[model samples]
Target: MKEGIHPNYRDVLFVDLSNGFKFVTRSCVATKETGKAEDGRELPLFKLETSSESHPFYTGQQKSVDTLGGRVEKFRNKFAAFKK
Candidate 1:
């Protein structure tokens, strides 16, 4: 609550590049770009690589990794000398 020592907080526009999703929220981050919202209001524009709109977990599109195979292969390699 100190005066003249806090960063400016205002509405900022965050754009998800993957799905072209845009939203406005209050933040203290700095930006040089601006974007217009659905209501025709201009605000600071920030770009993001991933967001809930296109994230695999949020969208229920998670991919399964072959971690079990990797662990089995590593175990076999580590104990191969003992078996010989």
Candidate 2:
């Protein structure tokens, strides 16, 4: 690969803020902070609100969203005439 035209790629510590879970992976994202990984390696810190580990869909905790007055209802109502 060419040099000086690409962002610096290195290991980064991705942390799930909801559960404090952490994992290390290579990334080119920038950060002004640093954190230590499980193996004691200092890496750039990146925070995540939801990862596969903590996501509702992946955790088997997802809920149905077909609620009253929701967008689904609005769509169905608006398109009701077109259905016939």
Candidate 3:
């Protein structure tokens, strides 16, 4: 609530480069880019490498690792000498 000590927060457009998804939200990030939205309004543009639209986890394309099985196999191999 202090005056002249806070960065300006305004509506900015975040564009997902991988999927071309854009959304307007308020942020204090600085950018030198600008773009026009579908509503004919120009807003500050921020580019992102990955977003929910293109992320593997959000898109249900994430790969599941068989870590438990691998660890069990390693343990069995390491303790094989004791079994004998």
TM-scores of all predicted structures: 0.83, 0.73, 0.77
lDDT agreement with native, every candidate: 0.94, 0.92, 0.94
Error of 3 at 6 (Å): 2.8
Put down candidate 2 lDDT per residue, 1-84, tens digits, no spaces.
787898778999999999999999999998888999999998899999999999999999999876766987899999999999
Ten residues in sequence with the least summed lDDT for candidate 3:
1-10
RMSD of each: 1.8, 4.4, 2.1
Identify the runs in model 1 with alpha carbons over 4 angstroms from their true place. Answer: none
User: Which RMSD does model 3 reach against the true structure?
Assistant: 2.1
Off by over 4 Å in 3: 78-84
Residue lDDT tens for model 1, 1-84: 778998889999999999999989999988999999888999999999999999999999999899999999999999999996
Number of clashing pairs, model 2?
Answer: 0
Q: After superposition, how far is residue 56 of candidate 3 from its true place, in Å?
A: 2.0
lDDT, candidate 3, 1-84, per-residue tens: 779998889989999999899989999999899999888889999999999999999999999998999999999999999999
Q: Count the backbone clashes (under 3 Å) in each candidate.
A: 0, 0, 0
- Candidate 1: what lDDT? 0.94
